[model samples]
Target: MDDDEHLLWQRVLAGDDDAFAAVFDLHASRVHRQARRLVEARADAEDVTAMVFFEAWRRRRSVRIVNGSVIGWLLVTTTNVARNRERSRIRYEGLLRKVRVETVPDHADEVLDSFMRPAVRGRVREAFDGLSTRDQEILALCVLEELAPADVARLLHVPAGTVRMRLSRAKSRLRAALGEDHGRSTLAGLGGTS
Candidate 1:
């Protein structure tokens, strides 16, 4: 957290909508970029980013700022929110098929496909899909979000030392799943696929 962000957070905690919006303006692009790297589809990443900010606003009164940055909290929330979005998408598709409705083409996906390949995203996701949910959250916060273990520990309600130990163990399991050749940090690129 920098001096400006700290002041914005203080105003945000004071229920200043404009301050919150300013924070959003400052971080939204990076959030979406990170979300895109994590989620396979553009729409899902957009949904995740939007939901992250929504939850931030809803929980603003209760937010715990670690190192004076709320973006850390939002990034972690994106991981969880993206998972919920995927589950909902699966359930919704199941219902659509049950009703015999033709599935619509994802226009957003079509647009995104022209510029980016999701091959790497798919491989990373496959590796993460094998992990426990607890492991996924820790990896997302510590490795992907680049947040301090102390900050992550505050979010997970554990000791900083315990968070570090768990991160080491989680990385080991991820490496075994993804193979030693895959960089350890790339495991976090899988997002919250679990």
Candidate 2:
């Protein structure tokens, strides 16, 4: 297996598009899964996955392969990509906080606000953001994505029972964050019909 991978990598080094695609096909899912563990949204995870592969190609010469697998390097790249995005998000939020709005109320704004309910959304977002990374990940996988506990367990490499327990606890904490009454309905919505 190691020899096959090494040969394929050598082909990649020689500018074989097919070999590069083969490598991506072999590792894309694993890279995406790792990215999802660090990011909150599915879209962001997908972005990170793409960025990881892009980086792998761009820095192909520097990628380390151990035991015939480049997965370790891919995972490390995923972590760096996710952290960079998080830092960017933080800086953007800080910039938003610094900006002051002093516009007069408009009828169109009122109409949009009436239906959009930005306040409620903000509250829910704030509550969700307050959770620890593990809790957030569990909620994102099981609740937001509506993935089965067993599937999440497999992806996370944890027992199904542990996934269930962590999900329960995470839900409870989300409730605490949003206040019980509001949290119950919101959790159901966020978690879907599962």
Candidate 3:
């Protein structure tokens, strides 16, 4: 670690705001440039840059300050934030498309109205919130993003079969949480079935 980096981090740990700001100023430009390369949108890159700094501040104690340099950590966070933004956008678009196209020909009003109910939407989000982080992550990738099992496995560094099995277990847990029978038909709506 650079001696200067070590000094800055030590001051940051001592609650020195000025020291933290100095660190931010020193790293911001390089981080922003890298973030832009990953996200491909100036506004998104800016947001990701801001988020990276915010996360660094929020988790300062846990940050690995190898050799008094946080560049490596910031780069990793930038990649993850960019990917998360992309995934969220994809999931939102997928759900929006599904809402537009999915309906009962004769009972369109009922179907749409049921889905639009605030209570129903809240219940679904609540069910997801209740799941373990691993389950939630796998479900988000496999179900919301409609990624294949192998793809999810590769991204998460788990075996393909584990991804499949975990998705099945997560779905079962979701069904139990919401007291709903989300079997093949519901999984079909998500663009896959375990």
C-alpha positional error of residue 63 in candidate 1 after TM-score superposition, expressed in Å: 2.1
Report the C-alpha lDDT of model 2 over 1-194, residue by residue, as the tens digit: 77888889988888888999999999999999999999999999999999999998999998899888888999999999999999999999999999997898679767646633889889888998999999999999998788999999999999999999999999999899989988887887666422
Worst 10 residues of 3 by lDDT: 182-191
- Candidate-wise lDDT, in order: 0.79, 0.89, 0.83
Predicted model with the maximum lDDT: 2
| Residue-by-residue lDDT tens digits, candidate 3, 130-186 | 999999999999888878899999998989999999999998888778775644445
Task: Find the 10 residues in a row with the least total lDDT in model 2.
Answer: 185-194
Residue 58, candidate 1: C-alpha displacement in angstroms: 1.3
Better of 1 and 2 by TM-score: 2
For every model in order, what is the number of clashing pairs? 0, 0, 1
Order of the predicted models by lDDT, top scorer first: 2, 3, 1
- When 2 and 3 are scored with TM-score, the better candidate is 2
What local lDDT score does residue 78 receive in model 2, on the 0 to 100 scale? 99
Model 3, runs deviating above 4 Å: 101-194
Over 4 Å off, model 2:
104-194
| Candidate 1 residue spans exceeding 4 A from truth | 99-194
Error (Å) of candidate 1 at residue 147 is 66
Candidate 3 residue 42 C-alpha distance from true site, Å = 0.4
Better of 1 and 2 by lDDT: 2
